[model samples]
Target: MGSPGRSHRRLPQAPDRKTSIQEAALLPISRRQALALGGAALLAGSAGDARAASPQGQLTWAVHVSLAPTWFDPAETPGMITPFMLLYALHDAMVKPMPGQTAAPCLADAWKMAPDGLSYEFTVRKDVTFHNGEPVTAEDVKFSFERYRGTSASVMKERVAAVETPDARTVRFVLKKPWPDFLTFYSSATGAGWIVPKKYIQQVGEEGFKKAPIGAGPYKFVSFTPGVELVFEAFEGYWRKLPSVKRLVLKVIPEESTRLAALKRGEVDIAYSIRGELAEELQRTPGFTLKPVVIQGTFWLYFPEQWDPKSPWHDLRVREAAALAMDYKSINEALTLGYSRVANSIIPDSFEFFWKPPPAVYDPRQAKALLAAAGFRNGFDAGDYYCDASYANLAEAVLNNLQEVGIRVKLRPLERAAFFSAYAEKKLKNIIQAASGAFGNAATRLDAFVMKGGTYAYGHYDDLEALFAEQAVELDQKKRTELLHKIQRLVHERVIYAPIWQLAFINGQGKRVRESALGLIEGHAYSAPYEDVTINTG
Candidate 1:
């Protein structure tokens, strides 16, 4: 399939029942359906007409989080999907998840996996060039992979024995063993496959590169004001298509009200992460589009203290009680305006080899009993509940529920980056409302959160780790699926996590915007395919 321009309107298949988030949460896409969602390759035939289209206007975004320089560099991806917002504009990936497809070809025109599953090769697009006019080659791909120090880097490096540049346009990856999720990890899940200019990075040191990063994407970096905004200009020579908007500006607006105000006053073309009353107001207001993007991200309560034998959370009854205490349905209705799907597991239902667990049972009485059984008849001090500051409201709601069930905790909200940093460093204690919006299937999710030595994992279980290891090398699809499902079942049965729900992020678009690229990519919360974004000047 050819690379889709702004006019491309094909969307992924939705749940059979359109009734509610609760009803839809029970239905899981079959393995066949999940496999069918594989992305398409871009054809040069589509590029001619797309490149010929003249660029115009400017698009501004009132982003919910503060802009970080780390996001500008794909090699430093935090293992989450948020960085993709900037990476999509400033850089291009060999294989990327696009609208209507999960692993669409971008920098690499075509790629093939060896029959033995030990090697993979990609044919780089010859027409592709960085913003600095340097052609992307196999060497650059190798260099980028070698230099990747982001999330999952250690595992990627361990699994891949060598990266070979057979020709200028051909890059081959020879794995130490048959790792089935190689593409999912390298391409869709992490930024390891996102190509950067080899010659330019070598010339400019890492810090200098961050100051003025360049790429082969549709938009080129123009200027950046720390904690204020980022500016970009369209790169006409982009391999995919010339960006419809000539200028792109991303302004940091941490407050939801301020973002909404900016959108209402026409200060910004798009505003992200509008929730609760603000979201409702946006939906009711005229001349505005309130888009609820059903992202692949799932919010869950993580008990870092659970692994500690001396901690109260270590008791099975305590963990079970926490899971039972959550009123997820009410939270979904109140916060997401009933648009978010109530999740039973962190692994998204749309992913390959997904196992749909039973619907969550909200039983406050049972929760109280479990706490009593665990020797906490009058409740226990669960210390602080750490969460992303932007989702403090959700955390507050969770805390309220936990309070009622005798699992008392204080709310400790931190900035997004700070929270991740603290969590990664294992400095955080007590409860953590964690989430993952990164792309990939179930095994990848387990590797990061459940398996030992993961980027964000606090602890691991021996049995689950064994299962994970077994699935990693299992070449048979049927056997692998069974092993993965068993692992998820173990997690569910043990109540390792108190799942909240799959997020349905609310965003606003102004009347000036024609195509915001909102909901263009399945499970991506932000407006994307920045090249396809257009405006209505008339």
Candidate 2:
């Protein structure tokens, strides 16, 4: 598939007055979406975007989604973007994502693989110290790895035969097989990379640790109010350069207008997840700057019930028809403001092993023909199309497109927690408009989303499972790359899921804040290396 070029559109002029904050929150879509349609024109005519020219002091960030203590624990964290926002602030991994690179040294200063590829050794950084004044040791690394009970833990347990510490500052992992993506697997972008103090957790217990978490990251957890706010202070004892901001406050502002209003009023240093006309307004306005990043993920449709042969979705023709109904270009223009690209396969284009198939062609006539051949010419009720409220606009757009090709679905919006919980409990029915942002190569993504017994997968295919298993242990880079390509081709040919487009996150920053280091790392959606970020004083 051909790569799509970036496009820009001028923001329409703002009106004289702003809508009431209360009214703005109740809109069908986000305040940014409403702003794109001229509902909140006050943002356009507002004052200049400039702010106090300083990089120091407290940095208050207004996040678009709410967070809870459930997400703070690295061991229990489910794969999602919101939780990682706090995780990045309060924790450090053995290896972290370097600026523009996927993996770099962190707690583990250096690492090497054995000649046989089954055993890997890491030389732990001796200077690293936790927030509580205790030096990080190899035992802490072993404990943290064993304590992990998250979605990826099963994969780790299956692949890792043992975690051995030869010395206080040296740790080694003996794998059952030669996993080709071991470095990416243990990178900070995933849960396995996060290291915690074993002594502290043992003394405080899991519940107690969540309330007052301690880590060896640049920031130390001060306090947390579930679903509302979290506070962190710069860790002076950090091995790396200390964070410029003395205090960091992550305020959970679910409403888009509230976040924007906070940024406009200079109440917050940064506001995340701003999109559509609001992003454009920030770009045109003087005091605010819009930072757009294309994350490595795709907003696609999943048919959980399709695994059952009785369901219409079980038919490939029906699934292909559903995929064909989506107009990727139109959806990208409407929702992303032309900032996103149409996804050609499950693996995002950013990955090294990403396979670019033919670009998706929108053809309602062909889609109708497929559906008719599958015995649904007039379209069948697909039941509720459930998704998190954050994706309301995208879900509605998909529903409209599907309706045009005779695949009817009603939008059922749920709170973020409820939406994720439903999927975790395997209660999701009919079609689900969901997304996956796992950071790694194509093999990592395919294993997590499509392989048998995968955390996010519901369907099972023995042949595909065999291929994935083979690729996971294949040491030859060329052979592994070819295997990954084959898996992507199978996913595309089977239409396992209807991939829509790759979504980009738009962040609004007050001019006072110069976030030079804040950007996607290994396609991480919530990456913010606070230690490197400064609130520009000039």
Weakest ten-residue segment in model 1 by summed lDDT: 1-10
Clashes of 1: 0
lDDT of 1 by residue, 1-538 (tens): 1221112222222322233223323323223223223324122234545345688888899999888888889898875778989998899998788765676667876666666678878888767899999899999999999999888888899999999998999898999998878888887888999999989988998988999998888899999998899999999888777788999999999999999999999999999999888999998899999989888898898888788899999999998898999998898988889998886898887778789999998999999999999999999999999999989999999899999999999999998888888887889999999898888889888887878988788888999989999999886778999999999999999888888899998899999999999988888878888987998977
lDDT tens per residue, model 2, 1-538: 0000122122233433344334334432222222322322322222123332332588888877667676778887665556667777788887655454345456766566676677778778767889999999999999988998866678878889999999999888999987756766676335877889999999999999988889888888888787688888888766656567788888888887788888999988888888766777777888778877788767788888778989999999999999999988988876667888787677789776889988898998999999999999898999999998877888988899999998988899887877887876778889988887666667777766788766678877888998888888776667877888988898888889889988787788887777635563546666477766777778
Error of 2 at 155 (Å): 1.6
Instruction: Estimate TM-scores for all models.
Output: 0.92, 0.87
Model 2 alpha-carbon miss at residue 399, Å: 1.3
Candidate 2: the clashing residue pairs are 48-287, 49-286, 49-287, 49-288, 50-287, 54-536, 54-537, 55-535, 55-536, 55-537
- Candidate 1's displacement at residue 102, Å, is 1.5
- Give the Å error, residue 392, model 2: 1.4
lDDT (CA) per prediction: 0.83, 0.74
Question: Candidate 2, TM-score vs. the true structure?
Answer: 0.87
